[model samples]
Target: MREFSEAYLERTREGMWDDSRQALAPLALDSRERVLDVGCGTGELSRVLVAESAGEVVGCDADRELLEFAGEHVPVIAGDALRLPFPDDSFDLVVCQALLINLPDPAAALAEFARVSTDLVAAVEPDNGAVEVDSSVPTEERLESRARRAYLEGIGTDVTLGADAREAFSEAGLDVLETRRYDHERTIEPPYGEAALTIAQRKATGAGLADDRETMLEGAMDDEEYDALRSEWRAMGRDVIEQMEDRRYRRSEEIPFFVTVGRVNGPQ
Candidate 1:
């Protein structure tokens, strides 16, 4: 599994559920008795689960450090996704957000979730391949799409597992219920905040691309190709900063997420 910094998770997941939570309807949270959020890093979704469900929401993660932050919101425990700490039928609903995409064997993890959940299993995953970016900087969109393709090709796990998660549910012996699409859009415009400024800085320095250098190289992209891409990325970043300074920069990234819900033990 890929490990992520709390800051990274926070930045990526910011305002994810703020837009519209209608996609979460299939989980039927209001009547849930017990809910377990696996890979509940920093408790972003865990807090939402707590808010939507009257039942107790427990967070479980393999990262002890992350668990510390999550523990602040709801009950947390250090546990692996493939091997949960609780026994069978421990939770009425078992769910994960952006977790399955990082796992090499998502079906195996779903199987484990099925073991613990007597009722439903759900996953909120993004289709990174389908990410759409619109930016005021002319080259920014092209460069971002280029970089994203390489990263997706190089990444070991299925980062684009979005709506196709139904296959995994079947493999885990769960009956497919429904899948809902949720568009999580992040935008940057005038009055740039600290986070936005920091991200722009990273772009100017090519630090963002540098972070994924190894992964991009693992794909069909060679060193020379990566170097050229990074150069263009940095140049685009400078343009973004200039536009921001003039209060003319505007960017929006729309990531499509699929909320796949499945039922265990067929129907009651």
Candidate 2:
């Protein structure tokens, strides 16, 4: 599995925290409740929850690299979401963001969430069923391609859980209180645009590009040609961003989850 480095995780944290915090604002947290953040990448959300709730927040993740970067921002520990280190009913609220869909056993993880949370559990997960790509590609092809990529990225079997998250919570015996959709659009600028190009290049490289394509991407182009290629790539990203702004090119979608106070119906 290609785990993200601490640096990359931190970068993502800085860039995406605002949208995450906004997605969480509707949860109506109590000021005195203790919260648990499962898969708390870089402790960004945990920090926000602590500050916002004026309460204690503990974050847990399997990746120590990310947790090391998260040091002291919030109380972070290295552990699996599927088997949390905490005891039953240890936390009043549990919040997981962009974490469940990537787990090998999402149901098991949710069971753990239900186990540890006494009052409520809320999770924000991507809606794979709502994924929209460019109209130029067939929807089925896009879905298959995304599934293959996700599998390669080590998120386990492909399942569209966006519409099923509520059911999952209910199965874990938590009452589903609210489910909302949040739309986010990100615009990459200049060199950052080049980084996107680099990612596509890497994907193509990994996917076995033709000799000419490989050569072009492997620095065979002249300085001017390279600059032109980068410029073209940046232009393409801008175009995609514009299309997304106009609801043309669809890239991502998420269902922000909220489950109210409940208890496990059976043995944990």
Candidate 3:
């Protein structure tokens, strides 16, 4: 599994559930007795589950550092997604967000989730391949897409596994119940925040693309091509900073996340 930094997790999950949570209705959270959030990095989803569910929400992750951060919100334990610490039928519901897309064997993780849960198993995963970006910078969208394509190709797991998570559930012997689409929109406008400024700086220095250089090279992109892309990306970043200074920069990125819910087939 790929390990994410605390900052990266926070940046990606910021304001995740702040919008309407209608997509989570299929989990039947209101009636849940005990909920287990596997791969619950920083407990972003676990906190929301705690707020919506009458039951107790426990978060589990392999990263002890992240588990410590998550402990601030809900009870947490260090555990692997493929092998949970609890016993069979330990919880009424088992869930994860942005977890499956990073796992090499999603079906195996689902089977483990089924083993631990007596009722529902759900996954909220983003379809990275379908992401859309709108920016005031002319080259921003194109550069982002180019970088994203190479990164996706280089990623070991199925980063694009969104609604398709149902296939993994079926392989794990879970009955597919429903799939809901939720668009997580992130926008950057006037009065740029600390994060926005930091991102702009990273872009200007090519630090952002440099971090993914190894992965990008794993794909069809060679060192020469990556250098070319990085040059363009830095130029775009400079334009973004210039626009930000003028208070004319505006950008929005919409990531499509699918909430796929499934039921354990056999008796608990």
TM-score of each: 0.98, 0.65, 0.98
Which is the better candidate, 1 or 2, if ranked by lDDT? 1
lDDT of each: 0.94, 0.59, 0.94
Q: What is the C-alpha RMSD of each candidate to the true structure, in Å?
A: 1.5, 9.0, 1.0
Q: Ten residues in a row with the worst lDDT in model 3?
A: 8-17
Q: Which order, best to worst by TM-score?
A: 3, 1, 2
Backbone collision count in every prediction?
A: 0, 0, 0
Tens-place lDDT digits, model 1, residues 80-122: 9999999989999999999999999999999999999999999
TM-score of 2: 0.65
Query: lDDT tens digits, residues 1-268, model 2?
Result: 2255654555434445465555555566645478888888788677777768867888898888788766778888888887899889898778887676666566677789888876667877755545443332134234334433433333343235654677677777666766766543443333334544443343333321221233344343444644444454444445544544455443332222332233445546
Task: List runs of model 1 lying over 4 Å from the truth.
Answer: 266-268
What's the residue-level lDDT of 181 in candidate 3? 98
lDDT: the better of candidates 2 and 3: 3
